[model samples]
Target: MFVAAIVGLLVSMLFALVRAFLGPTIYDTILSVNVFGTKTVLLIAVFGFLMGRPDFLDIALVYALINFVGVVAVARLAQSLLRDKVAMLIACVCDSQWDC
Candidate 1:
Protein backbone atom coordinates (compact mmCIF):
# COMPACT_ATOMS: atom_id res chain seq x y z
CA MET A 1 0.00 0.00 0.00
CA PHE A 2 2.72 2.46 0.95
CA VAL A 3 4.73 1.62 -2.14
CA ALA A 4 1.72 2.20 -4.32
CA ALA A 5 1.12 5.56 -2.71
CA ILE A 6 4.74 6.51 -3.20
CA VAL A 7 4.56 5.59 -6.86
CA GLY A 8 1.34 7.55 -7.31
CA LEU A 9 2.80 10.61 -5.69
CA LEU A 10 5.83 10.41 -7.93
CA VAL A 11 3.62 10.24 -10.98
CA SER A 12 1.59 13.20 -9.82
CA MET A 13 4.77 15.18 -9.16
CA LEU A 14 5.92 14.52 -12.71
CA PHE A 15 2.63 15.79 -14.07
CA ALA A 16 2.89 18.91 -11.94
CA LEU A 17 6.39 19.55 -13.27
CA VAL A 18 5.11 19.25 -16.82
CA ARG A 19 2.35 21.73 -16.12
CA ALA A 20 4.78 24.09 -14.48
CA PHE A 21 6.98 24.03 -17.54
CA LEU A 22 4.16 24.43 -20.06
CA GLY A 23 1.54 26.52 -18.27
CA PRO A 24 0.02 29.33 -20.31
CA THR A 25 0.28 32.04 -17.64
CA ILE A 26 2.41 32.98 -14.68
CA TYR A 27 -0.37 32.07 -12.30
CA ASP A 28 -0.73 28.62 -13.87
CA THR A 29 2.96 27.97 -13.50
CA ILE A 30 2.90 29.13 -9.91
CA LEU A 31 -0.02 26.87 -9.14
CA SER A 32 1.70 23.89 -10.66
CA VAL A 33 4.87 24.55 -8.68
CA ASN A 34 2.82 24.77 -5.53
CA VAL A 35 1.18 21.47 -6.37
CA PHE A 36 4.59 19.91 -6.91
CA GLY A 37 5.78 21.12 -3.55
CA THR A 38 2.68 19.71 -1.87
CA LYS A 39 3.20 16.35 -3.48
CA THR A 40 6.81 16.35 -2.34
CA VAL A 41 5.72 16.80 1.23
CA LEU A 42 3.28 13.93 0.91
CA LEU A 43 5.93 11.73 -0.59
CA ILE A 44 8.31 12.46 2.23
CA ALA A 45 5.71 11.59 4.82
CA VAL A 46 4.77 8.32 3.15
CA PHE A 47 8.36 7.31 2.62
CA GLY A 48 9.16 8.04 6.25
CA PHE A 49 6.35 5.82 7.42
CA LEU A 50 7.40 3.03 5.17
CA MET A 51 10.92 3.21 6.53
CA GLY A 52 9.84 3.59 10.18
CA ARG A 53 11.69 6.85 10.60
CA PRO A 54 9.41 9.40 12.25
CA ASP A 55 12.05 12.14 12.04
CA PHE A 56 11.37 12.46 8.34
CA LEU A 57 7.96 13.86 9.16
CA ASP A 58 9.60 16.85 10.81
CA ILE A 59 11.68 17.46 7.72
CA ALA A 60 8.58 17.25 5.60
CA LEU A 61 6.80 19.78 7.79
CA VAL A 62 9.67 22.20 7.48
CA TYR A 63 9.73 21.76 3.72
CA ALA A 64 5.99 22.44 3.59
CA LEU A 65 6.39 25.67 5.54
CA ILE A 66 9.18 26.82 3.30
CA ASN A 67 7.16 26.00 0.25
CA PHE A 68 4.18 27.97 1.49
CA VAL A 69 6.30 31.01 2.30
CA GLY A 70 8.06 30.85 -1.07
CA VAL A 71 4.78 30.70 -2.97
CA VAL A 72 3.37 33.66 -1.03
CA ALA A 73 6.52 35.70 -1.65
CA VAL A 74 6.45 35.01 -5.36
CA ALA A 75 2.75 35.86 -5.60
CA ARG A 76 3.26 39.13 -3.76
CA LEU A 77 6.15 40.07 -6.02
CA ALA A 78 4.08 39.34 -9.12
CA GLN A 79 1.19 41.39 -7.80
CA SER A 80 3.48 44.30 -6.97
CA LEU A 81 5.00 44.27 -10.43
CA LEU A 82 1.58 44.15 -12.05
CA ARG A 83 0.31 46.98 -9.89
CA ASP A 84 3.35 49.10 -10.73
CA LYS A 85 2.84 48.58 -14.44
CA VAL A 86 -0.79 49.57 -14.25
CA ALA A 87 0.08 52.66 -12.24
CA MET A 88 2.69 53.64 -14.75
CA LEU A 89 0.21 53.26 -17.59
CA ILE A 90 -2.34 55.41 -15.77
CA ALA A 91 0.28 58.05 -15.05
CA CYS A 92 1.24 58.16 -18.69
CA VAL A 93 -2.39 58.61 -19.69
CA CYS A 94 -2.92 61.38 -17.12
CA ASP A 95 0.23 63.21 -18.18
CA SER A 96 -0.93 63.25 -21.79
CA GLN A 97 -4.25 64.87 -20.89
CA TRP A 98 -4.61 68.67 -20.61
CA ASP A 99 -6.92 68.56 -17.58
CA CYS A 100 -6.42 66.82 -14.24
Candidate 2:
Protein backbone atom coordinates (compact mmCIF):
# COMPACT_ATOMS: atom_id res chain seq x y z
CA MET A 1 0.00 0.00 0.00
CA PHE A 2 2.79 2.40 0.81
CA VAL A 3 4.39 1.67 -2.54
CA ALA A 4 1.09 2.32 -4.23
CA ALA A 5 0.79 5.67 -2.48
CA ILE A 6 4.26 6.67 -3.58
CA VAL A 7 3.50 5.69 -7.15
CA GLY A 8 0.29 7.71 -7.06
CA LEU A 9 2.15 10.73 -5.78
CA LEU A 10 4.73 10.37 -8.52
CA VAL A 11 2.03 10.20 -11.14
CA SER A 12 0.34 13.28 -9.72
CA MET A 13 3.64 15.13 -9.75
CA LEU A 14 4.15 14.20 -13.38
CA PHE A 15 0.73 15.60 -14.28
CA ALA A 16 1.48 18.78 -12.41
CA LEU A 17 4.76 19.15 -14.30
CA VAL A 18 2.99 18.73 -17.61
CA ARG A 19 0.40 21.33 -16.66
CA ALA A 20 3.12 23.71 -15.58
CA PHE A 21 4.66 23.51 -19.02
CA LEU A 22 1.38 23.71 -20.92
CA GLY A 23 -0.46 26.19 -18.74
CA PRO A 24 -2.22 29.00 -20.64
CA THR A 25 -1.13 31.79 -18.29
CA ILE A 26 1.70 32.58 -15.90
CA TYR A 27 -0.66 32.23 -12.95
CA ASP A 28 -1.67 28.76 -14.11
CA THR A 29 1.93 27.72 -14.40
CA ILE A 30 2.66 29.08 -10.93
CA LEU A 31 -0.28 27.18 -9.51
CA SER A 32 0.88 23.95 -11.11
CA VAL A 33 4.35 24.38 -9.72
CA ASN A 34 2.88 24.95 -6.30
CA VAL A 35 0.85 21.79 -6.63
CA PHE A 36 3.96 19.83 -7.61
CA GLY A 37 5.78 21.09 -4.55
CA THR A 38 2.90 20.08 -2.33
CA LYS A 39 2.89 16.57 -3.74
CA THR A 40 6.63 16.33 -3.17
CA VAL A 41 6.10 17.11 0.48
CA LEU A 42 3.53 14.35 0.71
CA LEU A 43 5.84 11.93 -1.03
CA ILE A 44 8.62 12.68 1.41
CA ALA A 45 6.37 12.18 4.38
CA VAL A 46 5.08 8.88 3.12
CA PHE A 47 8.49 7.57 2.20
CA GLY A 48 9.78 8.57 5.63
CA PHE A 49 7.03 6.53 7.23
CA LEU A 50 7.77 3.54 5.07
CA MET A 51 11.43 3.73 6.00
CA GLY A 52 10.76 4.17 9.72
CA ARG A 53 12.58 7.48 9.92
CA PRO A 54 10.81 10.30 11.78
CA ASP A 55 13.53 12.80 10.86
CA PHE A 56 12.25 12.94 7.31
CA LEU A 57 9.14 14.68 8.56
CA ASP A 58 11.26 17.60 9.71
CA ILE A 59 12.88 17.84 6.32
CA ALA A 60 9.51 17.72 4.67
CA LEU A 61 8.24 20.53 6.87
CA VAL A 62 11.19 22.70 5.98
CA TYR A 63 10.74 21.98 2.31
CA ALA A 64 7.07 22.92 2.54
CA LEU A 65 7.95 26.25 4.14
CA ILE A 66 10.52 26.98 1.49
CA ASN A 67 8.12 26.09 -1.27
CA PHE A 68 5.44 28.38 0.15
CA VAL A 69 7.83 31.27 0.51
CA GLY A 70 9.35 30.79 -2.90
CA VAL A 71 5.99 30.68 -4.62
CA VAL A 72 4.79 33.82 -2.86
CA ALA A 73 8.00 35.64 -3.74
CA VAL A 74 7.71 34.65 -7.39
CA ALA A 75 4.06 35.72 -7.52
CA ARG A 76 4.86 39.11 -5.96
CA LEU A 77 7.67 39.65 -8.43
CA ALA A 78 5.42 38.83 -11.36
CA GLN A 79 2.69 41.20 -10.07
CA SER A 80 5.18 44.03 -9.65
CA LEU A 81 6.50 43.46 -13.15
CA LEU A 82 2.97 43.53 -14.55
CA ARG A 83 2.26 46.74 -12.67
CA ASP A 84 5.40 48.33 -14.06
CA LYS A 85 4.41 47.41 -17.58
CA VAL A 86 0.96 48.97 -17.11
CA ALA A 87 2.53 52.13 -15.74
CA MET A 88 4.84 52.35 -18.71
CA LEU A 89 1.94 51.96 -21.10
CA ILE A 90 -0.02 54.69 -19.29
CA ALA A 91 2.95 57.01 -19.48
CA CYS A 92 3.39 56.31 -23.17
CA VAL A 93 -0.26 57.02 -23.93
CA CYS A 94 -0.20 60.22 -21.90
CA ASP A 95 2.94 61.44 -23.62
CA SER A 96 1.51 60.78 -27.07
CA GLN A 97 -0.52 63.65 -28.55
CA TRP A 98 -2.75 61.35 -30.61
CA ASP A 99 -5.53 59.46 -28.87
CA CYS A 100 -4.70 55.79 -28.36
Candidate 3:
Protein backbone atom coordinates (compact mmCIF):
# COMPACT_ATOMS: atom_id res chain seq x y z
CA MET A 1 0.00 0.00 0.00
CA PHE A 2 2.79 2.43 0.90
CA VAL A 3 4.59 1.63 -2.30
CA ALA A 4 1.44 2.24 -4.26
CA ALA A 5 0.98 5.61 -2.59
CA ILE A 6 4.52 6.54 -3.42
CA VAL A 7 3.99 5.56 -7.02
CA GLY A 8 0.82 7.63 -7.21
CA LEU A 9 2.60 10.62 -5.75
CA LEU A 10 5.35 10.28 -8.31
CA VAL A 11 2.81 10.22 -11.15
CA SER A 12 1.02 13.25 -9.78
CA MET A 13 4.30 15.09 -9.39
CA LEU A 14 5.11 14.40 -13.01
CA PHE A 15 1.75 15.81 -14.10
CA ALA A 16 2.30 18.89 -11.97
CA LEU A 17 5.69 19.41 -13.55
CA VAL A 18 4.14 19.20 -17.00
CA ARG A 19 1.50 21.75 -16.06
CA ALA A 20 4.13 24.07 -14.65
CA PHE A 21 6.06 23.85 -17.88
CA LEU A 22 3.06 24.31 -20.14
CA GLY A 23 0.90 26.71 -18.16
CA PRO A 24 -0.21 29.79 -20.15
CA THR A 25 -0.20 32.14 -17.17
CA ILE A 26 2.32 32.90 -14.44
CA TYR A 27 -0.17 32.10 -11.68
CA ASP A 28 -0.89 28.65 -13.13
CA THR A 29 2.80 27.90 -13.26
CA ILE A 30 3.29 29.05 -9.70
CA LEU A 31 0.39 26.89 -8.51
CA SER A 32 1.82 23.86 -10.27
CA VAL A 33 5.21 24.44 -8.69
CA ASN A 34 3.55 24.72 -5.28
CA VAL A 35 1.76 21.42 -5.85
CA PHE A 36 5.06 19.79 -6.67
CA GLY A 37 6.57 21.02 -3.43
CA THR A 38 3.60 19.69 -1.43
CA LYS A 39 3.90 16.27 -3.05
CA THR A 40 7.60 16.17 -2.27
CA VAL A 41 6.89 16.73 1.42
CA LEU A 42 4.33 13.95 1.43
CA LEU A 43 6.74 11.60 -0.31
CA ILE A 44 9.42 12.25 2.24
CA ALA A 45 7.05 11.50 5.11
CA VAL A 46 5.86 8.24 3.56
CA PHE A 47 9.37 7.08 2.76
CA GLY A 48 10.45 7.79 6.29
CA PHE A 49 7.58 5.72 7.67
CA LEU A 50 8.36 2.84 5.34
CA MET A 51 11.98 2.88 6.44
CA GLY A 52 11.10 2.95 10.17
CA ARG A 53 12.78 6.28 10.72
CA PRO A 54 10.67 8.66 12.78
CA ASP A 55 13.30 11.35 12.38
CA PHE A 56 12.33 11.71 8.77
CA LEU A 57 8.99 13.18 9.74
CA ASP A 58 10.73 16.06 11.46
CA ILE A 59 12.72 16.84 8.36
CA ALA A 60 9.59 16.57 6.23
CA LEU A 61 7.75 18.99 8.50
CA VAL A 62 10.54 21.51 8.26
CA TYR A 63 10.62 21.15 4.50
CA ALA A 64 6.86 21.62 4.30
CA LEU A 65 7.07 24.84 6.30
CA ILE A 66 9.84 26.19 4.13
CA ASN A 67 7.98 25.27 0.94
CA PHE A 68 4.85 27.04 2.14
CA VAL A 69 6.83 30.16 2.99
CA GLY A 70 8.57 30.14 -0.36
CA VAL A 71 5.30 29.81 -2.23
CA VAL A 72 3.73 32.66 -0.30
CA ALA A 73 6.73 34.86 -0.90
CA VAL A 74 6.61 34.19 -4.62
CA ALA A 75 2.92 35.04 -4.72
CA ARG A 76 3.50 38.30 -2.86
CA LEU A 77 6.29 39.23 -5.20
CA ALA A 78 4.12 38.56 -8.22
CA GLN A 79 1.35 40.70 -6.80
CA SER A 80 3.79 43.52 -6.14
CA LEU A 81 5.09 43.37 -9.68
CA LEU A 82 1.58 43.46 -11.12
CA ARG A 83 0.72 46.49 -8.99
CA ASP A 84 3.88 48.26 -10.05
CA LYS A 85 3.14 47.66 -13.71
CA VAL A 86 -0.36 49.01 -13.33
CA ALA A 87 0.95 52.09 -11.54
CA MET A 88 3.50 52.66 -14.28
CA LEU A 89 0.83 52.43 -16.95
CA ILE A 90 -1.33 54.91 -15.09
CA ALA A 91 1.59 57.25 -14.67
CA CYS A 92 2.34 57.07 -18.38
CA VAL A 93 -1.24 57.98 -19.21
CA CYS A 94 -1.29 60.86 -16.74
CA ASP A 95 2.05 62.24 -17.90
CA SER A 96 0.87 62.24 -21.53
CA GLN A 97 -1.99 64.54 -20.52
CA TRP A 98 0.39 66.84 -18.57
CA ASP A 99 -1.32 65.85 -15.31
CA CYS A 100 2.04 64.99 -13.63
- Give the C-alpha miss distance for residue 62 in model 2, angstroms: 0.8
Q: For each candidate, C-alpha RMSD in Å?
A: 2.4, 2.2, 2.3
Question: Which prediction has the highest lDDT against the true structure?
Answer: 1
Backbone clash pairs for candidate 2 read: none
lDDT of 2: 0.93
- Model 1 stretches astray by more than 4 angstroms: 91-100
Count the clashes in each prediction. 0, 0, 0
Model 3: lDDT of residue 89: 97
**Per-residue lDDT of candidate 1, residues 12-72 (tens digit):** 9999999999999888898998999999999999999999998999989999999989999
Over the full model, what C-alpha lDDT does candidate 3 score relative to the true structure? 0.93
lDDT tens per residue, model 3, 2-58? 899999999999999999999999988999999999999999999998888979999
TM value for model 2: 0.82
Candidate 3: where is the Cα deviation over 4 Å? 92-100
Candidates by lDDT, descending order: 1, 2, 3
lDDT (0 to 1) per candidate:
0.94, 0.93, 0.93
